[model samples]
Target chain A: MTAPEVVSEDPEDTPAVLADEVEHVRKTRPRTNEDDMTLVGSVLGGLATTWLLYERVLPFSGALGFFVSWYLVFLAFYAGLTAVNRPRAVVVDRVMTSLVIAAPSVVGLALASTVVVTLSHGLPALLHVNFYTHDMSGVRPSDPYTTGGALAALVGTLIEVSIAVAIALPLGVITAIYMSEVGGRGARLVRTIIESMTALPSIVAGLFIYSVFIAHFHMPRCGFAAALALAVMGLPIMARASDVVLRVIPGGLREASYALGAGKFQTVWHVVLPTARPGLATALILGIARMVGETSPLLLTSGASSFLNWNPLHNPMNSLPLYIFNAVKSGVPRNEVRGYAAAVVLLLIVLALFLLARLVARGRNRG
Target chain B: MAGSSSLPTRTSLRVVDEVEDVPRRVVARQSTQDLAFTHGVRSVGFLTLVIVSSIGIFLGVQAKPTLQHYGWSFFTEYRWLPNLDTIGIAAAFVGTVEVAIVALAIAFPLSLLSALFVSDWAPAWMRPLLIRLIDLMAAVPGIVFGLWVLLFIQPQATHVAHWLSEYFGWIPLFKVHTDVHYPIWDQAPGFASYEGSAFIAGIAVSMMIFPMATSVMREVFSEAPAGEKEAALALGATRWAMVRTVVLPFGRSGIVGGTMLALGRALGETISVLLIISEAFKIKWNILESGTATISEVIASKYNEATPAQLSALLTAGFVLFLMTLAVNTVAASIVARSRSGAGTEL
Candidate 1:
């Protein structure tokens, strides 16, 4: 198709043939049509110019500098091309549209790069079955990559997270029930406190548990104490999320139960809770996700262990996050690779939990 | 047949009148089970409050000895030498703010643009997936980001730091006191000086908090009045103009609240900062420099090896961080609540 020479308010300057093509349509939608060639051409031109500037003209050599300058040059090119036929306002709008679209792409690129880099760095450690089967009990940081693993940390994380879930889930849901179903002055106060508690630094939870249990109470640093710290961090998150979920449960369902002569408790048990079950699962998953990767809390409450200790209450337990922290901080390249591998495991677990939550949420939406 | 219909109608009318005539003061009688359940829920709620509050109380109590020993000097002293019986959080506080500022500076614009794009520019079929992508970003553990920063980005970031210091050296915040001259495209010996700066730590943290801020802003942007948006479009406003005038104004409080929430998270961010920063116990304003200490990072790095006295000092630092985050979170929550009500948007 022939390009429009100049699109303007003056009738003759506009393309009459293109106008005729769109005339039969209502044309009520926002005018967003643009030349495909201009978009492609500007981007290519920008890349070429940036390469020339960086390699031939400018002294800049880093990838970051090149990409940053390329983006700026691309915007300039886009503006220059669009302004050829379009008004200044239209040119500005087009440039902004490109920018808005570019922002998400940049974010997505960063995320993708992080995943790729992490996998590349950690994949070697994960190749060994030993990585999943053994603990670093006697292995030194300078040992070969296959000599030790994070099996103890993996088991410890599962134990501690489950205990935290067991402690916090019921209380969080009930607190949500209180705020949503049993409205009173105290509920309001409790709600405000809970909201603020959600902001409590995860480290503070560790400090609290350390002081109260390990320091003052003379308790051993065990996975149970770490679990308690995780519970402290996870409780407010679960309560807040579950509160929102419960509040979204339809009131009509509650009234239906009440109209059937069911008491408040029975109605809540049979009606409200059932209706919000999927949402509650989401809250549960989210709470787990929030606490599962908490290193600071585990660092303080559960001292790092190099043994495969199954019992959470009896000994120092190592979770995945603490394992990563220790390994990375060990300043050994081999150990740091193992740490990255454990981080990959942690990321996968979180991803799986979130996917499950999403599945439940989707089912609820369809139902 | 007429008598039968009239009798039923009279019965219905009687029922309707009975319902309408019922006193407003009438209440449902609670069964014993209902009463017990309500009390159970209330008590559980109270238990949660107790559990959460005990954190604050425990910190306050554990920190008491250290606070008493240090007096106001705790706030004034910059060094943390517990071995010498000297400790303070003044520098840590400044470092926390510096890192948070750098994080928010990088995160805010990115989140705002991403939210706007997702809400306005994305095709309907792609919206949910985009949202999920953002949410997934949030689920990535901080340790992973820290690893990425320490291993991958730190080297590349050193170059950017050098460039910034070269161009913006007049701004003290970007200045580094190195003797190395700029345009050093190669990784010179002096480049190692830029490796563990607050700028690098902040960049890692910015990624960690970006998803949260984006989700909040997206929620508010979607709640912009459809009528107003359409009216602006109908009035020949360009798509960008419509967004600038309608969506931006409507989402203003969301931006502020989201920024503050992200700031709160950045301030308390532990693993990433701990991984990326080299510990220094001096007040430093230059984020491009390599030595600074944040409250959470200090606590994390020191807690394992600290003496009881040092532990108490660390707890005091934790207490301060807790208060800072709590205040930021409360204010952000209130702003978000107000905006939600004003927009009449349900979660």
Candidate 2:
């Protein structure tokens, strides 16, 4: 494996069999058989030379600088070495391959840095047990990490998001059923509308609710209103995803039930819906994931409050997203840490929801 | 599962007797079922329609005052100063388009290349993992990305922005006289208050929108007809050549649709843009300089503590943002629909 293999195609290129796997229509992926030691050796050499040369002229320091520069230097060194023996096409292919890989590597770096930074910055507050139990009441942002917790924001978020789910889940599932099962003349239009609704921005959703319920109707800035705003944003997502899940249900299942002398209604109720239940559950999780971290919508609909408010109907309620949104803007280190802690909590919840979605989806063995 | 025995042609019996024999007895039962299901579903279905309609009408009604006040100037004028009862969304509209264009420019090509690799070029073991990575990018909350940009990217981005302004200043878009505020470890104070510039926001948004573009293009490329790919390869085409001839042209509509979809998202993006850009009322040509305010950003930043007139103005801005996204989405939807047809019903 020291030398690169330039074979265009071989029997080894056979596409792996996976359920519902598309793509890989062409059973040809160029093999890169370069020696691991040489690759790592070149990268190390590139790093040494780049550090020496760039230390004087380049304005980068520490690991970040090394990490960023290694890619550029390593690519040049690796490709330049490869071009010494390989044809121009092989060199070009290898370079392009590295560049493509780099795109995602950079994105992965950003995502990882986000999580790590959030976790590390929030760790101080998280070490305290009361962080989850206590509210922000009587807690100063400048006070020690032992003082305040995200309890109020946590409860506020739970209430708002749950209420939103309470409203959106049933309606969204019903709409999805309508689209997939009872589709008719307005089905196309409803579908288009739902698709567009999926594009509806959080701020816009907030503005819609703010104007209609708050300004026009004089509704208070309560968690329920915030929930309504979230519902508006979450419904189309749930409906759209559920419709997709429902559509993927085999038509033959319906036919089988019909063959059993079951009407369309019975077939849909007993066969289609039941069979697609897992998928629908995934859709529901995804919809909740979509709305749970929403900030702009809650900011407008639910006025921020520092105290833990029990009633969501008549008074201001603070959500975690909005709390973070407010806290981060203060530009204080402690406030920033608090925001980061809240963010980590929200991120963990969304991660759990997505995992649940994937977990629930595992039972469905699509043919 | 659509078992083979259930196939109509495979059936020994026409099954008409099996179906018809029970219908007479089951009609009563099924009619009630049908009525209940249809009635239940239709009412909920109609509610969806109402929700959609109401979102539009409610926003429109709220925007009426602003629209009446501004008339055509609402869209035409560029200056936005609401407290003094003088405002128009011209600057915000241009800023939104500018930022979105810059974002698309960066993200579009990268997403296409990534999608190509994930769908056709990557090793079998890597493809699913990379595809899942793209999905993960899409699943992450926008606020997390915003915070990342704020905490990490902005301080580092100033160097790049400074380098561009220093070297590529000959270009109009790059011509800016902004100071580079390096991290305090290297220098004194880091942020010069303009760290969250338009270009930074654009790049941050590119990260956010990249997943969407990749997903669409991956789906399109994956749907390329297997027969055509085999033919292209059979004709002695290289992998790249085969992709160009077989996959790319097939996925062209999908690419356009994906780009347009990403563009729409970038336009209406609030949290990230709000976090990254310093609010400004007027449009500027230099992307590197800070003070970029998009329509959605304007609403998010200004909705609180806004006077009635200001609130109305922000609503008008939100409405405009809505319509713009709607137009983009409709186009994307149509393009995707057309691409599905062009894929020739393999779905």
Cα interface RMSD of each candidate? 7.0, 3.8
> Local error of candidate 1 at B152, Å?
1.5
Cα deviation of B36 in candidate 2 (Å)? 2.1
Q: Which regions of candidate 2 are displaced past 4 Å?
A: A1-49, A56-70, A73-80, B1-30, B178-194, B227-238, B341-347
| Model 2 residue A222 lDDT score | 97
Model 1 misplacement above 4 A = A1-34, B1-27, B182-189, B342-347
Candidate 1: tens digits of C-alpha lDDT, residues A282-352: 77887788788888889889999999999999989999999999999898899988988998889889999
Alpha carbon lDDT of residue A24, candidate 2?
41
Per-residue C-alpha lDDT of model 2 across residues B1-347, encoded as one tens digit per residue: 22222334422334455455332222233367677887788789889879966887767777898888879988887776665667888888888988898889889988888888888888899887787667766877788778878888887787677666666878988866444433342243334434667888888788889999999989999999999999988986667777878899999999999999998889888888888888877768888876767898888877877877778788878888888998998899789878885321112
Each model's backbone clash number: 0, 0
- lDDT of candidate 2 vs native? 0.80
Listing every candidate in turn, what is its Cα RMSD in Å to the true structure after a full C-alpha superposition? 7.8, 8.6
Model 1's interface RMSD: 7.0
